[model samples]
Target: MPLPRPLAPTGRVAVVAPASAPLDPADAHAGLSVLRERGLRVETADPAGGPAAYLAGTDDARVAALNAALARDDLDALVCVRGGYGVLRILDRVDYAAARAHPKLVVGYSDVTALHLALWKEAGLPGVSGPMVASDWGVGLDAETEADFWRVVGGDAGYDVRGPGGEALTPLAPGEAEGVLLGGNLALVTALLGTPFLPDLTGAILFVEDVGEAPYRIDGMLARLRLAGVLGRLGGLVFGMFTGADVAPGRPTFSVDEVLAHYAPSVGGPVASGLVYGHVPRKSTLPVGVRARLTCGAEARLHVLDPVAA
Candidate 1:
């Protein structure tokens, strides 16, 4: 894990729209208010980059905004406006040299997971797999979610993450382990499997989550990971809510739990599910590539060893 780059109060953080354009421009504007309320100077591109198809802008435009954000020394962090798709198209074009020279916090989840995998491999750069501006910030963040979001991204380190209601993590397989915390959206992770961007999770406490992916689709991706020897490299396995992945009543399909039964054991270490870490309204802020310890007990707890910012 890299050393922390803690963001001081009132530090500047740029907002970049690297994925799809915002569904609601109102949300983007409100999201800006949310950040300003945190006492930070916020900068953003014309997030209204006049949609070029489904993307916020043409491939080159999105890449330019992100790379430009990295090149600036004034910014303490970078946050994505939203995530839909299109990151892979610009992955190869993003030059991380400038980011590597002066590392700053990068934040997003879902499609941005691909960016996390790429940046972590290219520059050992760390990012927040947590709330996004339009995604959570504009979705009416609750007291607890807002508090947790600031604590994690505000440069606090070594805090424990647990399931909803502060419940113990329920293990599918029992044990304890510790390693760099890595992983994000399952679909994005699956898409990067054979690519150079995939981080080598040799001793990683790997975690994954997704939304609307059916049971068989999840199973197929997990199977691919197992065959690629991805699962065997994990120090532990953590699964967040598989929102909307459930099969409908009377449908002849395997349950999400059933899919896990086939692959969780391949992890060669502890495995826990129902972790509140993805695709939900109340999302946890995860610092990519940070050292963390996972203890699977009657309650499972993960403690991030490094702060997100310097």
Candidate 2:
């Protein structure tokens, strides 16, 4: 897939909620302010008003909002307001044709992973697996996170993704591999399995992360990936922050690290952990479907080999 046009300094960005509504309206407003401060023209969709339980709105409303943004040639990018749930429910109804035609940057993570994977597979469109309005910008980004986000989106030259203090990721298995960067929230990626939306990850540098899932659950998901031959087809594998993976008191279970260790040997190439991308405040904004290289050893590094944006 070709890279989408980079966000111009004065680019027009449309903010829409395609998943769950914001937990706090104030946070959403604050996030929008951050975008304005960057000198970008920010447009927002009306709240898809409806009592649809956990969803931002009814399936039809969310789909309409997302599709409208995808079809707008005036927009340089579509920024998701937040990601909780609902994307999976409407993946089939998405406007893939408009996405292929417009090919604007679609930015968000978590539940937004479903949209990213679907857009990539169905329309050959690349996207930023980065922060969302209510999720990151609303609370304020750490210096590293803010810098990395703009650097990738602004069409800056290729660079290495490092920890907050320039530390290397922990090496799991020793080796080197290069492939397009793909994968996101573990649960979302796993859910897309057996679906047409899951991209062909053969030789792709797959990275995954999750929050609030137990070690056993993580083990099950990784097992499924291995059983489905997903792990064996990867050029490399990266484990990001698996936050909130602690087991309950008195529960007998393996540690998250142990679970990962059990599956590392099944990967086709190098493996690494501690990638600073996940549900945390500080993260490296990664571009999905972009070529990248990963080296797993004492001097481990993940390098973006292709420009994320044109």
For all candidates in order, the CA lDDT equals: 0.83, 0.89
Task: Tell me the TM-score of each prediction against the true structure.
Answer: 0.95, 0.96
Best by lDDT: 2
Native-referenced Cα lDDT, model 1:
0.83
**Ten residues in sequence with the least summed lDDT for candidate 2:** 45-54
Cα deviation of 133, candidate 1, in Å: 0.9
Q: How would you encode candidate 2's per-residue C-alpha lDDT over 1-310 as one tens digit per residue?
A: 5567898758999998888988888999999999899888999974467537888889888898889889988988999999999899999999999999888999999999999999989998988989899888999988888888888887765678886657578888888999989989999999999999999999999999999999999999999999999999989999999999887799999999999988998996899998988999888888888899999877678999887679
Off by over 4 Å in 2: none
Report lDDT (Cα) of residue 235, candidate 1: 92
Prediction 1 TM-score vs. true: 0.95
Q: lDDT by residue for model 1 over 1-310, one digit each (tens)?
A: 3443666547788889889988998998999998898787998864345778889998888998888888887888888999999899889888788878878888899999999889989988888888888988987787777777677777788778854356556778777888988999999999998788898988899889989999989998899899999899899988887888977789899888878867878998888887788888876777888888887767667778877666
